[model samples]
Target: MSASTPGHDDPVRPLPGWFDDAKLGVMITWGLYSVPAWAPLDDRLVRLLAEHGEGADRDRSYHAEADADGFDPIVTTSYSEWYQNSVSVPGSPTWHHHRETYGDRTYADFRDDFAAAVEQWSPEPWAQLCAAAGARYVVPLAKHHDGFLMWPSHTPNPHRPDWALERDVLGEFRDAAEARGMRFGIYYSGGIDWTFANLPILRADDVARAVPDSPEYAGYADAHWRELIERYRPAVLWNDIGYPSAAEPEKLFAHYREAVPDGVVNERFYAGTPDFLTPEYATRATSGGSKWETVRGVGLSFGYNRQEDASWTTSGPDLVELLMDVVSKGGNLLLGIGPDATGRISPEQDAALRELGAWLAVNGDAVYGSRSWRVAEDRTAEGLRVRYTERDGDLYATFLDRPSAGVSAPPRLAGAAHAECVWLGGDGTVGTVTGLAGLPVPPVRPGVPEPTVLRISPAPDPR
Candidate 1:
């Protein structure tokens, strides 16, 4: 396979079981952009349609992975977190905002402004929020492509000496999460740090060319990665873009393994078979030999997209359905939230998370500590999909759309012989059958989301 191809070859066997049980993780992307916190959520699906040939299916094109032949990454990356580099491209909307907002100021000035705002930040509340949101882990951006380190850094800043914070931001988050009994992870921009090489990527294919390549940059990234492992002992070492070519993949992996014995890594780097593969916003979902994760923004942008209103964001029901879809496909969801400059989670993002948490509070048995069934999904004649999960001899059926009416057909679990079927988060039995549980839309408080789950067991216990 070419260097740009998606898959890799290495010998990291079945990932730690704890990761498979962790159905949900929350990822925060906050940085200098959060100061301005604005980006245009372009009609990305429409852009893909325009890029694909004339006869491509419009519906499929919208959801199709952008990695197909001739597929471009530029059309897919609309993240507001990339404001620094995005603004450098002459005709982009970000560039227009930069020119109008601060005529002669550099992005470094924005960094200085962000540093001033960092004084008001605290990680405890964020950690508490994640725990409440039913997240098994929390991953925050360590250093983005912008190169502004969130924590006090021992590694030299490629461009400036005073670029990082004096406070141990990552340490604070780590302590808070560990206190909450949740694993802590770090998202490092291993491939490209704009300060080292600011390559304006205008087309989809320019992504490979954008990464800075040099022993200097490799050493810089290696130092930062080692420092993170040494200081944080992160459970998840998530990398983005790609690792610098000069960086030795094998040695880095060994170093990380030594730091955190059961450390889980994402597949974005080309080093080896990561604990899991990661498909970003516009990538194809893969499953089979290896574990995988799917990361998505609350809306179209990963950074706080000021332009994204309720219409652009996923509602509670949508999120539940999304989580079920990923789990059914044997993948985990690292739901992304972009906090504003004050470090407060957006109300929209918070609400969605809490909604998922509330649902999990009632139906967590169906999600957490569960494994995907051999047959992941079963579609009814009504076009609704019922996703399956198994745990401790009990079976779970998650409906993509809540059962507004009885499903035309529901799959019978192999040994399911329940006398009572309890609707998740609801009082009474929604359905009762020996083998299959059917729902006619269980009653729920107003504004409570759908995509309900039913616990199927041989025992008739109410609890």
Candidate 2:
């Protein structure tokens, strides 16, 4: 087997064919944070250095009580999924918010609140949305860093025996998703369970140090991993940070495969190369050496963040482009949606998903089960961004930007008639597109979000 180096494609690849065909998966990161659903996604301390001129009495002071204007895109953008750990830092933004809002209430309070709230929420809607969005699989957070289990597991949390949810969240989600023809996955915070770690994280270096490597914690995490497989039989075991250093990676992989034959794992296990490498926020985008994925929240925060306005999230058109980009680069896009404690997908998130599903309804043939083309991206004569995917012998060219009235057939496919050209949500036969004059003026309304997909076949040889 060949692997990719810094420059060229390697024949050795780490992904199973099912993963390559998957192309799109949905990740849900709901947990205790969903209750408060507060925190930024950025590495703010990095930004603070630039703001305060490099260690010059950095402003550890909290910003305005509510979502303030001029929040640094670099600073405000952060993973809300780690709210529990961030709040433990005492002076961190989440810490300040927790102290001020809940007034010294332990994280356990928020955990209980989430568990109570989830009792009223159902998993059906989440399943329906993933199906609608054309997700190949649905991965829900089973046990996040808060050490809270969504499933009623025999493997007790080393910290709290009574802490597990009464409801079988993973089972319900698995049934719901499988009912909709989507594979089920589980996200486990295997490396760092903050309840046991309990160490303050002031810096990136502190992050790794905080994972409790004690035999007790390792044994507990190992049991949870095995129990998850024994019960749910997830298709994907998405571990976070890393696995317990003591656990045997080979044994774990063997067990996962035995439980669910097609089961795959992510690179975060840190034991060795995983079935896939995951890049956050955007696609890894390196060519053909390995199976890779880009997992990102619809908004800046993975866990729901009330502070996120419309500006923080990827719009419908933008998300389509993102998926196209990732697919073109031989990767999958694990688009994340953070539901509230009540398990409601917020309106902002819901709208984008609906639009994505609608788009996929028409253009899915170009995405699902498609392989990366030799050349990933090119441009049309009209300057529209074009991404390529191949299925069978047919080539699909997806325009990143919505084509205007006067666009052209992709430049490389110049003078070539399209086998089939379709608008994202429009039916087939959009008239043959050309390089100079794009399409025959479709009946779409102005400002409505949609992209054009051109299926090009080789022009016939001179007869």
Candidate 3:
């Protein structure tokens, strides 16, 4: 990882080496919004934005109070974590559900329920699950857009007194993750805080304006951020939406780096420098050459959506392929898990994660500490998709689909001397590599098909 170019005032910061090697990470988005754990279960946010064009219509105002009909985007938003803002939109699905389920109760009214649920929660299972899934790091949300803090913060919210939890959930999670030899990070919603601005974002344009720019809010956010750094010393300082315009993010970045030299900052800081870029639900080909991460939930929403079942969530095999695709393009995958109010991971999500873990336990060498190869992708004669990755001077070819016996070698491997060929998940080498013209493929398994990895030693230089 190279150092980023310095801006006019912001200093240059190099990305931490461990980040690139840490191919997979888990992000936990559990907060007050989990109490309801409800969303419309509509199309993913990326698709909605593409179809609706960011909901920006100059002719009409889409504010909920002005015209509920114009705010179709918010009504169908899939992010359950935006409950506070969503419930504020009149006639929106969330608004209707809130009225019908818990009449006249404000979003903050669920505090007691959340606290009760937190009492039953334990960080042990979460950390163990992440470790089993071959995750190299864990990032838990400390504060979200709802302005509820998961930790007992020293800087209390002025508008919502006693809004933070007495228990240090973030610290507990960090300790559990680190105990398993995984790095712990924190995610903070620095841009929009409902307690500070109290604005319901109905359109894409509303997002920018929703950020609280008041000096008081800036000082409050800065204080909380500094506290988080000084206490936890997170490996990654991830921010979402944007930072306050009134705050000096450069100073914050300097403070964080000085406190933890190897810590990295994400690109969401609207004002300061970033150690890496974070692309939500984006493909490696689409994400640029810089150190970036692809973030998305097991289901549609980062906050648990009760309506989402196995059909709506990504399958285990698909998750493995997604990680391979992202890693092949020099990117990391920060998969998200949204637990319910009781901190219980849904069965559907848990199964998928375990399946992914099972696969990683067998073929992790193809992923962890691997870099992009000469060609990111190729197709074999059997029409099977193949992704390439390189580590320790060896080339890895991952077949997305099961390949038939005696599959033909890809054109890229032609003329390359294969010192050894080992089929991951199988006993050592698959017979002997007779020639470069053809290579043997592993037998197809009975149940769910998984990506097969073939590691070729002494890879031919692509230069």
Candidate 4:
């Protein structure tokens, strides 16, 4: 297989076909900082406090207090900022702080606390919900940049003795997904671990220094990655930022493939490009020279942000429409959830997932195990637009958006001969979709908004 070069202009290539089947997935985020019982999604209290005390000479006293308490003042100060910014701490920054301060705490201190939290983290309902909604696979954050192993690691960070999370969070998620018969994937951060390396920048210091390729850092990353691939053998490896140079991720990708031959690696490894192009927080106008998956947070934030306003949540119709639009053009959707300080996903997030799952359950036949039919038509031409995807003997002519006016049910296939249309909402009938416009228009509802889908017969051939 020929891979892309640094500055080459090439058409988007299909990632392994596995991605096509992985239309919808979930990204889970949890770590030590979540134990703080604070919401950082929308709050900036800690940041405000930090700024208030920014130039104060009290920095000296703060350091003394941190040393006496075995807490890293830099971390605490940064944590404050995280809370203020979004009520959530950034992964690398928070993890580095935790390791510096409490790396000496025994598993006896937080092991059960963390494990119990994960053991009770029943994503089965979530998975079942997603599958019911239309997701073929589920991806969990095996480990973020915090360097706190969700699985046990033999390679210990000498600097942060007690920081390794002994419990296997990924294993639990894997079992949960398999039990539900959903495919499992793992998200790994490629770089940025202050516990094992020096990042004066995150510590609020200016040091233009290169990260030393010391044995300690190498031993930690290599051993931990080996443990992840060897133990879980994840189907997909979802990664975070910090790649190409700092971590020499291409080397890691080579190692990953050698360890897990059939495993899939994302663009975060080589550079900003992934095995599939993952558009974060937004949809892409075109596939980025590869199969694509859009990973968007439910709200403005990805992690547990106690400060997030529930009113800012995403709606089921909008999300469903987004999925349809992407899948219609051949793409996948990766949704995210931030586990709270106690390792619990917020109720609001759960509701949003459930809503999506409900929508999927009703109209899943059109989504799961399907291929994009390359019909070129404008979605905005009318309220309801025609897009076809085929699976088995059925062709799905999905409505790009909602219906409007008296457009009756779903629009007909553009050039297909003699087919019946059935509304996915439990009604099976060929309703009135006659229009020269080649789309349907439904009567608008007063307040309730949802994207309606109709399955059309006489499936189109890929050729």
Model 1 spans > 4 angstroms off: 1-5, 45-77, 282-287, 404-408, 411-420, 428-432, 435-441, 445-447, 458-463
Residue 455, candidate 4: Cα error in Å is 2.5
Model 3 lDDT-worst window of ten: 1-10
Instruction: Write candidate 3's Cα lDDT for 1-463 as tens digits.
Output: 0001112223246668899899999999999999988988644444533332211211111111113335354545677888888899898889999999999988888998999999999999999999988899999999998889999998999998889999999999999999999999999988878888856876654665677879999999899899999999999998877778677998998999899999989877756778777656555453235687777788777889998999888888989998998888888889899999989999998888888888888888889998888788878777889888999998888999877767887767765664578778776776435344556658554443499888888666542
Decide which is better by TM-score, 1 or 2: 1
lDDT of each: 0.73, 0.71, 0.79, 0.54
- How many Å off is the CA of 117 in candidate 1? 0.7
Of 2 and 4, the candidate ahead on TM-score is 2
Q: Estimate each model's TM-score.
A: 0.88, 0.85, 0.90, 0.71
**Greater-lDDT candidate between 1 and 4:** 1
Worst 10 residues of 4 by lDDT: 1-10
Winner of 1 and 4 under TM-score: 1
Off by over 4 Å in 4: 1-14, 37-134, 198-215, 243-255, 271-274, 380-395, 404-417, 431-449, 459-463
What is the C-alpha lDDT profile of model 1 across 1-463, one tens digit per residue? 0013244554366688889999899999988888877665656544653443222211122323454465443433457886776677777777788788878787777777787777898898899889988999989999887888888887868677787877788899889999998999999988768778855555644555667888899999989999999989999999876788678866888888877888888766767667887655422232244676767776767778777777777777778877877776677888889888878887888888888877788778888988876666676666766877878867687877656665554544533454456677777765566545344666565555677777666432221
TM-score top scorer: 3
Give me the displacement of residue 462 in model 4, in angstroms: 14
Which stretch of 10 consecutive residues in model 2 shows the poorest summed lDDT?
A: 1-10
Candidate 3 colliding pairs: none
lDDT per residue, candidate 2, 1-463, as tens digits? 0001111122233466787898889999887778878875454423432342211221121211112444432223266766766777655678788888989688778767877798888889999998988899888988877788888888777567767888888888899899999988888887777678655444443444556778888888888889988998888989876666777665888788777777788767767546876655534334465777777678766788887767777788888888888888788889889998989998888888878877787788889999887777778676778888888777787877667775665656665544455554555566554432556544463444567676665331111
Candidate 3 TM-score versus the reference: 0.90
